[model samples]
Target: MPPQQALAIARAFLPKRPWGNRYDYYYTRAKLRTDPLYPGVLAALRDTPGPVLDLGCGLGLLAHALHVDGQPRAYYGVDIDASKIERARQIARRTGLKDARFEVVDLGARWPEHTGNVAILDMLQYLPSQVQAGMLAHVSRMLAPGNKLVIRSALGDDSGRGRTSKVTDLMAHFAGWMQEVPKSYPTRESLEGHLANAGLSATFSPLYGNTPFNNWLIVAERRAG
Candidate 1:
Protein backbone atom coordinates (compact mmCIF):
# COMPACT_ATOMS: atom_id res chain seq x y z
CA MET A 1 0.00 0.00 0.00
CA PRO A 2 1.05 3.57 -0.55
CA PRO A 3 2.75 5.08 2.50
CA GLN A 4 0.11 7.78 2.89
CA GLN A 5 -2.74 5.29 2.66
CA ALA A 6 -1.04 2.90 5.00
CA LEU A 7 -0.50 5.72 7.47
CA ALA A 8 -4.20 6.59 7.27
CA ILE A 9 -5.22 2.98 7.77
CA ALA A 10 -3.05 2.68 10.86
CA ARG A 11 -4.44 5.90 12.30
CA ALA A 12 -7.99 4.75 11.63
CA PHE A 13 -7.55 1.31 13.15
CA LEU A 14 -5.67 2.59 16.21
CA PRO A 15 -8.29 4.80 17.85
CA LYS A 16 -10.82 1.99 18.01
CA ARG A 17 -8.67 0.75 20.87
CA PRO A 18 -8.80 2.97 23.91
CA TRP A 19 -5.39 1.75 25.10
CA GLY A 20 -3.23 2.27 22.05
CA ASN A 21 -0.30 4.77 22.03
CA ARG A 22 -1.83 6.74 19.20
CA TYR A 23 0.72 9.54 19.27
CA ASP A 24 3.85 9.21 17.06
CA TYR A 25 3.08 5.51 16.65
CA TYR A 26 1.32 5.59 13.29
CA TYR A 27 4.18 7.62 11.88
CA THR A 28 6.70 5.05 13.01
CA ARG A 29 4.62 2.07 11.88
CA ALA A 30 3.66 3.66 8.61
CA LYS A 31 7.29 4.25 7.76
CA LEU A 32 8.37 0.76 8.80
CA ARG A 33 5.57 -1.13 7.05
CA THR A 34 6.00 0.72 3.80
CA ASP A 35 9.73 0.15 4.02
CA PRO A 36 11.25 -2.32 1.58
CA LEU A 37 12.33 -4.58 4.38
CA TYR A 38 8.67 -5.14 5.29
CA PRO A 39 8.09 -7.11 2.08
CA GLY A 40 10.84 -9.50 3.10
CA VAL A 41 9.31 -9.77 6.54
CA LEU A 42 5.88 -10.33 5.01
CA ALA A 43 7.21 -13.08 2.79
CA ALA A 44 9.05 -14.71 5.66
CA LEU A 45 6.14 -14.23 8.07
CA ARG A 46 3.72 -15.74 5.54
CA ASP A 47 5.83 -18.85 5.20
CA THR A 48 6.08 -19.57 8.91
CA PRO A 49 4.01 -22.68 9.59
CA GLY A 50 3.05 -21.45 13.02
CA PRO A 51 3.11 -18.10 14.85
CA VAL A 52 5.47 -15.13 14.64
CA LEU A 53 7.16 -13.94 17.83
CA ASP A 54 7.69 -10.19 18.12
CA LEU A 55 10.31 -9.32 20.72
CA GLY A 56 10.33 -5.79 22.13
CA CYS A 57 6.96 -5.31 20.59
CA GLY A 58 6.21 -1.78 21.77
CA LEU A 59 2.54 -0.91 21.55
CA GLY A 60 2.14 -3.69 18.95
CA LEU A 61 2.63 -1.33 16.03
CA LEU A 62 4.44 -3.90 13.93
CA ALA A 63 2.02 -6.60 15.00
CA HIS A 64 -0.97 -4.41 14.20
CA ALA A 65 0.50 -3.45 10.86
CA LEU A 66 1.06 -7.10 10.01
CA HIS A 67 -2.48 -7.94 10.98
CA VAL A 68 -3.73 -5.00 8.98
CA ASP A 69 -2.00 -6.07 5.78
CA GLY A 70 -2.69 -9.80 6.25
CA GLN A 71 -0.71 -12.24 8.36
CA PRO A 72 -1.35 -15.92 7.75
CA ARG A 73 -0.55 -17.29 11.19
CA ALA A 74 -0.74 -16.48 14.87
CA TYR A 75 1.75 -13.91 16.32
CA TYR A 76 3.01 -13.27 19.85
CA GLY A 77 4.50 -9.89 20.78
CA VAL A 78 6.70 -9.71 23.88
CA ASP A 79 8.05 -6.59 25.54
CA ILE A 80 9.48 -5.19 28.79
CA ASP A 81 6.96 -2.40 29.16
CA ALA A 82 3.83 -3.57 30.94
CA SER A 83 1.71 -0.67 29.79
CA LYS A 84 2.74 -1.13 26.18
CA ILE A 85 2.02 -4.80 26.35
CA GLU A 86 -1.31 -4.03 27.94
CA ARG A 87 -1.99 -1.66 25.09
CA ALA A 88 -0.95 -4.34 22.68
CA ARG A 89 -3.32 -6.77 24.34
CA GLN A 90 -6.10 -4.23 24.08
CA ILE A 91 -5.34 -3.57 20.45
CA ALA A 92 -5.49 -7.26 19.76
CA ARG A 93 -8.82 -7.45 21.50
CA ARG A 94 -10.25 -4.42 19.73
CA THR A 95 -9.02 -5.54 16.32
CA GLY A 96 -10.31 -9.06 16.88
CA LEU A 97 -6.88 -10.58 16.29
CA LYS A 98 -7.50 -14.09 17.45
CA ASP A 99 -4.07 -15.11 16.19
CA ALA A 100 -2.12 -12.45 18.07
CA ARG A 101 -1.20 -12.11 21.75
CA PHE A 102 1.00 -9.84 23.89
CA GLU A 103 2.99 -10.26 27.07
CA VAL A 104 5.66 -8.47 29.12
CA VAL A 105 9.00 -10.20 28.76
CA ASP A 106 12.55 -8.95 28.31
CA LEU A 107 14.46 -11.25 25.99
CA GLY A 108 17.77 -9.56 26.77
CA ALA A 109 18.29 -11.16 30.17
CA ARG A 110 16.80 -14.31 28.70
CA TRP A 111 13.92 -15.08 26.41
CA PRO A 112 11.26 -17.33 27.82
CA GLU A 113 11.74 -20.93 26.71
CA HIS A 114 9.39 -21.33 23.78
CA THR A 115 9.53 -22.51 20.22
CA GLY A 116 8.22 -20.80 17.07
CA ASN A 117 9.07 -18.17 14.46
CA VAL A 118 10.35 -14.94 16.05
CA ALA A 119 11.00 -11.40 14.98
CA ILE A 120 13.27 -9.19 17.09
CA LEU A 121 12.85 -5.62 16.03
CA ASP A 122 15.26 -2.82 16.96
CA MET A 123 15.71 -4.25 20.43
CA LEU A 124 19.29 -5.45 20.49
CA GLN A 125 20.80 -1.98 20.50
CA TYR A 126 19.53 -1.36 24.01
CA LEU A 127 21.53 -4.25 25.38
CA PRO A 128 25.21 -4.03 26.23
CA SER A 129 27.49 -5.64 23.69
CA GLN A 130 28.01 -8.85 25.67
CA VAL A 131 24.36 -8.98 26.58
CA GLN A 132 23.37 -8.59 22.98
CA ALA A 133 25.57 -11.48 21.96
CA GLY A 134 24.29 -13.68 24.75
CA MET A 135 20.74 -12.77 23.85
CA LEU A 136 21.32 -13.81 20.27
CA ALA A 137 22.82 -17.02 21.53
CA HIS A 138 19.76 -17.62 23.66
CA VAL A 139 17.42 -17.00 20.76
CA SER A 140 19.47 -19.23 18.48
CA ARG A 141 19.43 -22.07 20.95
CA MET A 142 15.67 -21.76 21.18
CA LEU A 143 15.09 -21.75 17.45
CA ALA A 144 14.33 -24.96 15.65
CA PRO A 145 15.89 -25.83 12.33
CA GLY A 146 13.23 -23.99 10.37
CA ASN A 147 12.45 -21.32 12.92
CA LYS A 148 13.51 -17.81 11.88
CA LEU A 149 14.82 -14.73 13.69
CA VAL A 150 14.01 -11.45 11.98
CA ILE A 151 15.97 -8.56 13.49
CA ARG A 152 15.72 -4.86 12.81
CA SER A 153 17.98 -2.00 14.09
CA ALA A 154 19.10 1.54 13.41
CA LEU A 155 22.55 1.56 11.84
CA GLY A 156 24.88 4.48 11.15
CA ASP A 157 26.88 5.89 14.02
CA ASP A 158 28.56 9.36 13.81
CA SER A 159 29.80 9.68 10.23
CA GLY A 160 26.50 8.68 8.61
CA ARG A 161 28.72 6.49 6.49
CA GLY A 162 27.59 3.52 8.47
CA ARG A 163 30.28 4.59 10.91
CA THR A 164 28.43 7.06 13.15
CA SER A 165 24.84 7.35 12.08
CA LYS A 166 23.49 5.38 15.03
CA VAL A 167 24.53 8.01 17.54
CA THR A 168 23.10 10.78 15.42
CA ASP A 169 19.78 9.03 15.08
CA LEU A 170 19.68 8.18 18.76
CA MET A 171 20.26 11.82 19.65
CA ALA A 172 17.69 12.95 17.11
CA HIS A 173 15.25 10.26 18.23
CA PHE A 174 15.30 11.40 21.83
CA ALA A 175 15.90 15.12 21.36
CA GLY A 176 12.36 15.94 22.33
CA TRP A 177 10.90 12.52 22.96
CA MET A 178 10.01 11.19 26.36
CA GLN A 179 12.03 8.03 26.07
CA GLU A 180 15.67 7.67 25.01
CA VAL A 181 16.77 5.40 22.23
CA PRO A 182 18.74 2.25 23.05
CA LYS A 183 22.48 1.89 23.63
CA SER A 184 25.18 -0.82 23.44
CA TYR A 185 24.75 -1.23 19.70
CA PRO A 186 27.21 -3.45 17.85
CA THR A 187 28.99 -2.26 14.79
CA ARG A 188 27.92 -3.93 11.52
CA GLU A 189 30.70 -6.44 11.81
CA SER A 190 29.89 -7.07 15.44
CA LEU A 191 26.19 -7.50 14.63
CA GLU A 192 26.94 -10.26 12.13
CA GLY A 193 29.31 -11.87 14.59
CA HIS A 194 26.57 -11.88 17.23
CA LEU A 195 24.39 -14.06 15.06
CA ALA A 196 27.27 -16.31 14.17
CA ASN A 197 28.23 -16.58 17.83
CA ALA A 198 24.64 -17.60 18.56
CA GLY A 199 25.02 -20.47 16.09
CA LEU A 200 22.69 -18.97 13.51
CA SER A 201 23.68 -18.21 9.96
CA ALA A 202 22.54 -14.66 9.29
CA THR A 203 22.10 -12.11 6.51
CA PHE A 204 21.49 -8.37 6.71
CA SER A 205 19.26 -6.05 4.70
CA PRO A 206 18.50 -2.32 4.78
CA LEU A 207 15.09 -0.94 5.82
CA TYR A 208 13.90 2.36 4.42
CA GLY A 209 11.82 5.42 5.52
CA ASN A 210 14.47 6.95 7.78
CA THR A 211 17.57 8.75 6.69
CA PRO A 212 21.02 8.46 8.31
CA PHE A 213 19.53 5.50 10.07
CA ASN A 214 21.62 2.64 11.17
CA ASN A 215 18.37 0.94 10.17
CA TRP A 216 18.96 -2.50 8.79
CA LEU A 217 17.55 -5.96 9.35
CA ILE A 218 19.12 -9.32 10.04
CA VAL A 219 17.40 -12.66 9.44
CA ALA A 220 18.84 -15.74 11.06
CA GLU A 221 17.97 -19.41 11.44
CA ARG A 222 18.94 -22.23 13.76
CA ARG A 223 20.30 -25.51 12.54
CA ALA A 224 18.98 -28.74 14.02
CA GLY A 225 20.94 -29.75 17.06
Candidate 2:
Protein backbone atom coordinates (compact mmCIF):
# COMPACT_ATOMS: atom_id res chain seq x y z
CA MET A 1 0.00 0.00 0.00
CA PRO A 2 1.11 3.56 -0.63
CA PRO A 3 2.47 5.42 2.37
CA GLN A 4 -0.11 8.17 2.29
CA GLN A 5 -3.04 5.79 1.99
CA ALA A 6 -1.64 3.58 4.69
CA LEU A 7 -1.10 6.58 6.92
CA ALA A 8 -4.65 7.75 6.33
CA ILE A 9 -6.03 4.43 7.50
CA ALA A 10 -3.67 4.52 10.46
CA ARG A 11 -4.85 7.97 11.47
CA ALA A 12 -8.45 6.83 11.28
CA PHE A 13 -7.70 4.52 14.17
CA LEU A 14 -6.55 7.36 16.39
CA PRO A 15 -8.73 9.16 18.90
CA LYS A 16 -11.64 11.05 17.39
CA ARG A 17 -11.20 14.34 19.18
CA PRO A 18 -8.87 16.63 17.22
CA TRP A 19 -7.95 18.81 20.19
CA GLY A 20 -8.21 16.63 23.27
CA ASN A 21 -5.54 14.03 22.46
CA ARG A 22 -3.54 16.07 20.03
CA TYR A 23 -0.20 14.78 21.16
CA ASP A 24 -0.98 11.13 20.45
CA TYR A 25 -2.65 11.92 17.17
CA TYR A 26 0.03 14.27 15.91
CA TYR A 27 2.80 12.05 17.16
CA THR A 28 1.37 9.06 15.33
CA ARG A 29 0.79 11.06 12.21
CA ALA A 30 4.27 12.59 12.27
CA LYS A 31 5.85 9.22 12.88
CA LEU A 32 4.06 7.79 9.88
CA ARG A 33 5.22 10.72 7.82
CA THR A 34 8.84 11.01 8.91
CA ASP A 35 9.69 7.43 9.74
CA PRO A 36 10.50 5.29 6.72
CA LEU A 37 10.83 2.27 8.96
CA TYR A 38 7.07 1.84 8.97
CA PRO A 39 6.94 1.38 5.22
CA GLY A 40 10.02 -0.85 5.26
CA VAL A 41 8.37 -2.96 7.94
CA LEU A 42 5.27 -3.39 5.82
CA ALA A 43 7.37 -4.46 2.85
CA ALA A 44 9.24 -6.98 4.95
CA LEU A 45 6.03 -8.56 6.22
CA ARG A 46 4.32 -8.67 2.85
CA ASP A 47 5.39 -12.24 2.01
CA THR A 48 5.82 -13.55 5.52
CA PRO A 49 3.30 -15.85 7.13
CA GLY A 50 0.69 -14.98 9.73
CA PRO A 51 0.64 -14.56 13.54
CA VAL A 52 3.21 -11.76 13.79
CA LEU A 53 4.83 -11.32 17.18
CA ASP A 54 5.68 -7.67 17.82
CA LEU A 55 7.99 -7.16 20.76
CA GLY A 56 8.09 -3.78 22.47
CA CYS A 57 4.99 -2.78 20.61
CA GLY A 58 4.23 0.74 21.78
CA LEU A 59 0.58 1.70 21.34
CA GLY A 60 0.37 -1.11 18.75
CA LEU A 61 1.17 1.20 15.84
CA LEU A 62 2.54 -1.60 13.68
CA ALA A 63 -0.46 -3.74 14.37
CA HIS A 64 -2.80 -0.93 13.37
CA ALA A 65 -0.67 -0.19 10.32
CA LEU A 66 -0.81 -3.79 9.16
CA HIS A 67 -4.55 -3.80 9.53
CA VAL A 68 -4.81 -0.58 7.61
CA ASP A 69 -2.64 -2.02 4.82
CA GLY A 70 -5.16 -4.89 4.40
CA GLN A 71 -2.99 -7.56 5.95
CA PRO A 72 -5.49 -9.79 7.74
CA ARG A 73 -2.94 -11.83 9.61
CA ALA A 74 -3.36 -12.43 13.35
CA TYR A 75 -1.22 -10.00 15.36
CA TYR A 76 0.03 -10.20 18.94
CA GLY A 77 1.73 -7.13 20.39
CA VAL A 78 3.66 -7.26 23.66
CA ASP A 79 4.96 -4.24 25.48
CA ILE A 80 6.20 -3.33 28.96
CA ASP A 81 3.98 -0.25 29.34
CA ALA A 82 0.57 -0.97 30.75
CA SER A 83 -0.86 2.31 29.53
CA LYS A 84 0.36 1.67 26.03
CA ILE A 85 -1.18 -1.78 26.10
CA GLU A 86 -4.47 -0.31 27.26
CA ARG A 87 -4.41 2.26 24.49
CA ALA A 88 -3.58 -0.47 22.02
CA ARG A 89 -6.57 -2.44 23.17
CA GLN A 90 -8.79 0.58 22.81
CA ILE A 91 -7.50 1.21 19.33
CA ALA A 92 -8.07 -2.41 18.39
CA ARG A 93 -11.66 -2.20 19.59
CA ARG A 94 -12.23 1.16 17.96
CA THR A 95 -10.82 -0.11 14.68
CA GLY A 96 -12.54 -3.51 14.95
CA LEU A 97 -9.34 -5.51 14.80
CA LYS A 98 -10.67 -8.92 15.77
CA ASP A 99 -7.41 -10.70 15.03
CA ALA A 100 -5.18 -8.43 17.11
CA ARG A 101 -4.14 -8.86 20.75
CA PHE A 102 -2.14 -6.59 23.03
CA GLU A 103 -0.61 -7.36 26.41
CA VAL A 104 1.69 -5.82 28.97
CA VAL A 105 4.64 -8.11 29.61
CA ASP A 106 8.10 -7.40 30.81
CA LEU A 107 10.41 -8.69 28.07
CA GLY A 108 13.26 -9.23 30.52
CA ALA A 109 11.21 -11.68 32.55
CA ARG A 110 10.71 -14.17 29.75
CA TRP A 111 9.72 -14.58 26.15
CA PRO A 112 6.00 -14.83 25.56
CA GLU A 113 4.93 -18.12 24.03
CA HIS A 114 4.60 -17.50 20.33
CA THR A 115 5.46 -19.05 16.98
CA GLY A 116 5.64 -16.93 13.89
CA ASN A 117 7.62 -14.16 12.19
CA VAL A 118 9.01 -11.70 14.77
CA ALA A 119 9.50 -7.95 14.60
CA ILE A 120 11.75 -6.13 17.11
CA LEU A 121 12.03 -2.49 16.18
CA ASP A 122 13.45 0.55 17.95
CA MET A 123 13.34 -1.12 21.37
CA LEU A 124 16.27 -3.47 21.80
CA GLN A 125 18.72 -0.73 22.63
CA TYR A 126 16.87 -0.04 25.88
CA LEU A 127 18.02 -3.37 27.25
CA PRO A 128 21.48 -4.08 28.57
CA SER A 129 23.86 -5.85 26.21
CA GLN A 130 23.52 -9.17 28.00
CA VAL A 131 19.75 -8.93 27.98
CA GLN A 132 19.79 -8.05 24.33
CA ALA A 133 21.95 -11.06 23.50
CA GLY A 134 19.75 -13.32 25.61
CA MET A 135 16.61 -12.08 23.90
CA LEU A 136 18.17 -12.64 20.50
CA ALA A 137 19.15 -16.16 21.49
CA HIS A 138 15.63 -16.87 22.62
CA VAL A 139 14.22 -15.46 19.43
CA SER A 140 16.59 -17.70 17.46
CA ARG A 141 15.32 -20.73 19.31
CA MET A 142 11.69 -19.74 18.93
CA LEU A 143 12.05 -19.14 15.22
CA ALA A 144 11.53 -22.26 13.20
CA PRO A 145 13.44 -22.87 10.02
CA GLY A 146 12.62 -20.47 7.20
CA ASN A 147 10.94 -17.89 9.40
CA LYS A 148 12.19 -14.29 9.48
CA LEU A 149 13.18 -11.82 12.20
CA VAL A 150 13.21 -8.11 11.39
CA ILE A 151 15.18 -5.83 13.72
CA ARG A 152 15.74 -2.07 13.39
CA SER A 153 18.21 -0.32 15.67
CA ALA A 154 20.61 2.59 15.83
CA LEU A 155 24.00 0.98 15.55
CA GLY A 156 27.00 2.52 17.25
CA ASP A 157 29.01 4.02 14.45
CA ASP A 158 31.43 6.93 14.30
CA SER A 159 29.59 8.66 11.48
CA GLY A 160 27.57 11.84 11.72
CA ARG A 161 24.27 10.01 11.70
CA GLY A 162 25.40 7.79 14.53
CA ARG A 163 26.38 10.78 16.64
CA THR A 164 23.07 12.42 15.89
CA SER A 165 21.14 9.34 16.92
CA LYS A 166 23.06 9.20 20.18
CA VAL A 167 22.15 12.77 21.02
CA THR A 168 18.51 12.24 20.19
CA ASP A 169 18.43 9.11 22.30
CA LEU A 170 19.82 11.06 25.23
CA MET A 171 17.12 13.66 24.78
CA ALA A 172 14.52 10.96 24.76
CA HIS A 173 15.97 9.65 28.00
CA PHE A 174 15.83 13.05 29.65
CA ALA A 175 12.27 13.52 28.54
CA GLY A 176 11.30 10.36 30.45
CA TRP A 177 10.15 8.68 27.27
CA MET A 178 12.75 5.95 27.60
CA GLN A 179 13.36 4.65 31.09
CA GLU A 180 16.26 2.29 30.61
CA VAL A 181 18.89 3.86 28.43
CA PRO A 182 21.87 1.57 28.21
CA LYS A 183 25.41 2.77 28.69
CA SER A 184 26.39 1.54 25.21
CA TYR A 185 24.69 1.07 21.88
CA PRO A 186 25.35 -2.03 19.84
CA THR A 187 27.83 -1.73 17.00
CA ARG A 188 27.10 -3.27 13.62
CA GLU A 189 29.73 -5.92 14.19
CA SER A 190 28.35 -6.98 17.56
CA LEU A 191 24.77 -7.07 16.29
CA GLU A 192 25.78 -9.15 13.27
CA GLY A 193 27.77 -11.52 15.46
CA HIS A 194 24.81 -12.02 17.78
CA LEU A 195 22.55 -12.94 14.90
CA ALA A 196 25.19 -15.14 13.29
CA ASN A 197 25.75 -17.06 16.50
CA ALA A 198 21.99 -17.65 16.62
CA GLY A 199 22.28 -19.33 13.20
CA LEU A 200 20.48 -16.52 11.42
CA SER A 201 22.02 -14.86 8.40
CA ALA A 202 21.26 -11.15 8.41
CA THR A 203 21.56 -8.49 5.73
CA PHE A 204 21.92 -4.85 6.75
CA SER A 205 20.62 -1.67 5.16
CA PRO A 206 20.32 1.96 6.20
CA LEU A 207 16.78 3.15 7.05
CA TYR A 208 17.05 6.90 6.88
CA GLY A 209 13.80 8.74 7.34
CA ASN A 210 13.12 12.46 7.25
CA THR A 211 14.89 12.65 10.58
CA PRO A 212 18.64 12.51 11.09
CA PHE A 213 19.38 9.23 12.83
CA ASN A 214 21.59 6.25 12.18
CA ASN A 215 18.74 3.77 11.96
CA TRP A 216 19.50 0.48 10.21
CA LEU A 217 17.43 -2.62 9.71
CA ILE A 218 18.62 -6.19 9.92
CA VAL A 219 16.52 -8.72 8.06
CA ALA A 220 17.53 -12.11 9.41
CA GLU A 221 16.24 -15.42 8.11
CA ARG A 222 16.77 -18.72 9.83
CA ARG A 223 18.38 -21.31 7.58
CA ALA A 224 17.48 -24.97 7.71
CA GLY A 225 20.12 -27.22 9.19
TM-score of each: 0.80, 0.92
- lDDT (Cα, tens digit) per residue for candidate 2, span 3-48: 6765675575556765556566667777777688878888888887
Tens-digit per-residue lDDT, 1-225, candidate 1 = 556546644664456558855664565555555566555576666665666777787767666667656665677888887877786787567667777788888666567665777787767777778888877787776676677888877653554545555655467567844243666766778888888777788777776554545577777887445
| Candidate 2 TM-score to native | 0.92
Candidate 2 achieves a global lDDT of 0.81
lDDT, residue 41, model 1: 72
Model 1 stretches with alpha carbons more than 4 Å out: 1-9, 16-29, 32-34, 156-158, 161-181, 223-225
- Root-mean-square deviation per candidate: 3.4, 1.9
lDDT assessment of candidate 1: 0.68
lDDT winner: 2
